[model samples]
Each structure stands twice: as C-alpha cells, then as structure tokens.
Target: MSPLKSYLDLYKHLPQTNCKKCGMAACLAFAAAAMRGQKLLSACPDLAPQVREELARELGQAADPQEELTRAMAPLKARVAAVDLAAKAGQLGCTHNGKRLVLKCLGKDFTVDPDGSLASQCHVNAWLAEPMLNYVSLGQGKDPLGRWKLLRELPGGEDWHRLFGQRCEKPLQKVIDEHRDLMEWVIDIFGAQAVEEEGSAELRVVLWPLPKLPLLIRYWPPEDGMESTLNLCFDATATDNLPIESIYTLGVGLVTMLEKIALTHDT
Candidate 1:
C-alpha cells in the first residue's frame, strides 16, 4: 500500500478533532507525515509522550511486516491467484444474461471448520455471502467482466476454492440451492440476458428461448454441519464484450455475478 493510502486509513480511524495540540492542524496531516516517514512520533504534542511511545512502537513492529506476511502467504496466494486468473479469463465458470453460475463444493466434500465450534460453522457460508449481498444492492448498470478483473487482484481469494475443496466431504446440493435462490433474486431484479440451466455441469450459453434467469442449485449432505455446497448461476453475456479496465472497475466476479443477475431482472 502507498503511504498516502496508509495515512488515509489511519486518518479515518483517528479522532477527527483539530485540537492542534498534536502540533499539526489536523489528524490527516499528521497521518500523512507518519506514512511518509517524514514525521517523528514525538511530533504530536497533543498525545502524551507515553501514548506516542506506544504508537511508535506499534508502527515500528509493523514496518517490516510485509516480508513476514509474504512468507506466511506464499502458498495460499498462488492457489487463489490461479483461480482468480481463471475467472477473469472466463475459464473457472460462465455467465448468461449477466447472471453467473458458480461451481460449488458442499461441506460434504470440502468444508472449513473454525475452532471446532457450532456457532462458527456458518462462518464460511456467511463469508461467501458478502458478494452476493452486494450484488443484490447494486446489480443494475454493473459491468460483470470488469468486476472479475478486479477480483483477480484481491488477496485471500487465492485460497477460497482450495480451502473449500479441502474442507468439503461429498458434493452436496442443498448449499447450491441456497446460493441459487440468492442469485435468482438478482436475476429477477436485473432483467438478465442468459443463465446457467439448472442441473447442467457444463458452461454453455444461448439467446433464443433464453435459458432460465437467476438459476439456483444445491448439494446438501446428509450430515448436519459437514460440507453442504451452494452453486449460483447467472447470465454470462454481460461480460463477453467488456474491456480490461472496465473489468477492473467492475471489481470482483462474485459480486459482479450477482449484480449481473439483478440487472437482468431489472431490464
């Protein structure tokens, strides 16, 4: 991240008051210098020397964090990057009428259990639902291809599919059904152009007698919290002719997929 961005993030979290006791006119200016390494911790007289010392210590600890992070993240990064690249290349899956059909592996086959707790069992599902939620709110006028391009660069994404696969047990359909229901709503709202036909494993498209919009499918495992999966499908055509930068702007396939589905329904 750039110094400016770092400063901005810190600034947002700061007490927005311009007390001037910090020697700077505003917290933002102080943050800017802190980010640029142009200001010293003691520069802020407003903060007690003890507080400044503590903050400085914390910042110093994080100064060389990138190297450590790189080491810890190397393996997972590669896996996610590959998937992201595939998604942008239109390889991982396809879309129709702006809706997307995602390949889902239920907990039966690959599930992620956090701390072996029941309350936490739904964490992963909730984590995956964020993009879907965003799509529901802003699907219309969205560029699905652009979104995929941006998603390719996001972190933690490289491990998403791999982690899911590892935790899964058997491919379940119930999860897919949940995901499908969510995407279907987006498709119905957006007036999509194409969709992934229910029960089909192949990535295919069509305009005439347009396939169903916002299709939902699921693979539910017999076990309770093992590894159920959700597969959400949408129209793919919305992304076919998009440009690279546009794709970047669209930012993240998961969300874009939902948006496309919603947009199709709206139209």
Candidate 2:
C-alpha cells in the first residue's frame, strides 16, 4: 500500500491545466505515470514546492501498477468472452471465419478468438490489445463522417487532449524532426494517403485505423522562428467508434509503431 493510493489521489491536487510543463502531455498522464513509478512527483513544475517535495518522498513507495492494469483489463477481457464476436462482426465492419473475428487495425490484421484472446501476425502490443477488446465489445460501430477534429474537440476529448498530444502528436513530431526525409517512406509503409490542408502543412496524410475510424496528420517543419509541428486528428465520429480512453491508447500505440518503423528503416 502506497501513500498515493490511486492516481486520482494526486490528480485531485494538481492544476488540471493539462499543461506540458512536466514533459507529460497532460496532468492526468503525469499522475498516472508517477503512480506507476515511471515519473517523479517533483517533475510537475506546477505543484507547490512543499507539496511536490512531500509527495516526492512518498512516490518511491508506491505499489506495483501492473496489478492495477491487470485489474482494469480483467473485466474488459471478460466482456469480450461474453460477446458473440461472430454475430457482431458485420456491425464492426470485420469478418468472422468461424473460429475468430478478424479486425483490421492500422492496416494490420488482428484476430480475436472466442475466449477474448487476441492474435496477430504482427506483435500484439500491450497498448493495443485493451482497446481492441473494448472496441469489439462496446463500440458503436458507426461509419466515420470524414470530417476531422482535434482530440480536444471530440466528445469527452477535452480531458484527454493533452495526453493525446503527449503520447501521439509530440512523439510523431519528434520522429519527423529527426528523420524528416524518411517520413514519406514511413507513411507509405502504413499505406497513409497524402492529402492537403489549408495551413501550409509540408506533409499531410490520412490513415484508416479501423473501417469507421480515420486519423489525419499534418506537419509543418521549423521556419521563421516557429518550431516544427505535427497534429494528429480524428474523425468527428471518433467517440462513436471507440471510447475516449481507448482512442488515446490507440494513438499512443500508433506512435510507438511509427517509432519502430522509423528505427527499423533508418538503420
């Protein structure tokens, strides 16, 4: 048992600004990371000097967060088992081949067995599995509207925007900054389609993470005293296809995959 019993214990104390001052995309992310022992409480510059110091003293004593993740996922996994995957496949714009329901994620095939276990030819990343199960079990399965909006603009996205930027957009910007030339190749590998935007984006691409879920990215290289930028946006119907938390997880997972792709090719 740790002094910080749960992430909310610390979340309640913060400014809730979602400011990136702590190097985390959002205040909520920082608190959760701190609870997981991945970050220090003192890392948040916004916290009172005394408060941060006090919390920092208790941070190192936190319990294992892996158990918490497991506890959180258990019910979602159980829900998958109760779902008639084959019967619901069509609604999800996926396929059923008797034994498994096959869903396409970021142009990759991930098959779900009747027991809620997932298998993919590609590695099943920890960030992606939970969301996949969640989508299959509870997603609204609506078709995307093709109209794009920021994570902050989507339903329930206000709370998640900063974290989404931290986990997805900022990392994508980092990749573009370091490996500018290789981006075309990376996007190509993911079958991303080049597109245009009004803001003079040097590169804009669209990708379909799911049949009803589309992601759009726009990048602007450094110029005229402005830093480089990358923005990851989603369809207006994003929440209809996946929950806000799952959407954030999926974005993080995509960024992780992009980093891997860039690394593998740059070498």
Candidate 3:
C-alpha cells in the first residue's frame, strides 16, 4: 500500500469522535495531517503509548521540519561559538528534511497576557548527578538514557567514603546529589540577565535545532495588561529538526509565570 494509505489505515483504528481536541475531526483527518507533516503525534490525545511510538517511528522515517533542521545544524548538541551565536541571534535560517525556516529574533520581545489567563501545564525536571557508572542490562533494545547508572554509584564514591569511612550506607543520598548537580548544571548553562520590569521579564535559553536562534521567553502579569509570548527567533539560515529544550524551557517558563502571578496578585 502507499504510505498515505497505510497511515489512513492506522487512523481508522483510532477513536474518531471528531472531538477536535486532537486538532482534527477524526483519526483519518489526523492521519492526513500527519502525512502532510503538519501535526505532531502528541496532538492526538486519544493515542496510546504504543500507537504514539509507532507513529513517531513512522514520522521519523518520513520527512519532517525537525529532521530538516537536524541536517543543517547537525544534531542539536553540536556547540557553536559566541560570535556565531550573536550573528545567528540577529538573523538565522535553516532548512532540513523538507522543512523551511526563515526568521529574525533580535530586538523582539514577549509580554505576558495581562489577564493571567494563559494556559499552563504541569511539569517535572529531574537530573542525575554522579552518573551511574554501571551499564544497565538491556535485554534487547537500547537502554533508556542510563536508567541503571545510579544503582552502582549509590554505594560509595570518593566523597562518600571520605565522610563515612566506607562504613555507613545512606539511601537515596546519591539520587539527591545527582539531582542537585543536574539542576546546578542547568542553571549554569542557562543563566539569565537581570532585568526588572513591572509587567514583563525577559529571559533567553539555548535551543538546539537552531543554534543561531536563542528562544526568548517572557513572563507578564495580567494586571500589567500584557499577553505572554514565547518567541523562537532564527536567522535566515537556521536549520530544521533541531532538538528543542522543551522540558526545561516550558518548566522554567511556567515557574517564572507563577512568580509573576504571585507578585501581581500581592499588589
């Protein structure tokens, strides 16, 4: 069967209530959108994990904006110098995997909605310090980002033995240490400039897919009569399929919004 026909067949199995919650009327509609490379797998709330995984695999095999960015910039983790970043920050553009990108982010600003009505979601940020040294025994497929790394490290490290003389065992101590270390690294990697404003605060964070573009995130209070905006700025050459720091950006952005909300409410 043709690729589009295959996807439509899968969609036929999906619950097609046309809920519109998934941004489409029915599963077939979503499948078409997916074929067109326009919608994300996450958009379908009704999809089970297995289904989602299947779709993601299929999508990865297909052309995508993210893949396009990846080819232009090379994996999201490839580092770029400050001067390059500055030039890209002013103007960045990239294309990969059949996706086109063109934009400029310099001098752009984001303001929070003054009404305090922006839809926010729950988030979690977990980090592991003193990474687990042991290889997790994966029976088959690739192990998930060092899931078993902590098991061996928990017993004793240089510092742990130094303090306890190798006699005591502290449970979950390693876990705590790892998480703290991760958070510290995160903060160091994405430090913000101090800018005080009544209704809005501006911060920038590195997003991988487009090294030339730094995401400008803002928080504003409803009382200030501003709408919150997250701007992804890029030069004309910024690439597609770049890995986004989605978790960190969204999690931290939400916290910043809450802080602003508290400040506004108090006043």
**CA deviation > 4 Å runs, candidate 1:** 1-150, 153-179, 197-267
Write candidate 3's Cα lDDT for 10-33 as tens digits: 576567766544434456777776
lDDT, candidate 2, 75-103, per-residue tens:
67788999999899999999999999999
Worst 10 residues of 1 by lDDT: 108-117
Residue 102 C-alpha lDDT in model 2: 96
Report the C-alpha displacement of residue 19, candidate 2, in angstroms: 9.2
Rank the models by TM-score, top first. Answer: 2, 3, 1
lDDT of 1 by residue, 214-242 (tens): 22222332346564444322234333332
Instruction: Give model 1's TM-score versus the native structure.
Output: 0.22
Which candidate leads the pack in lDDT?
2
lDDT ranking, best first: 2, 1, 3
The prediction achieving the highest TM-score against the true structure is 2
lDDT of each: 0.34, 0.80, 0.32
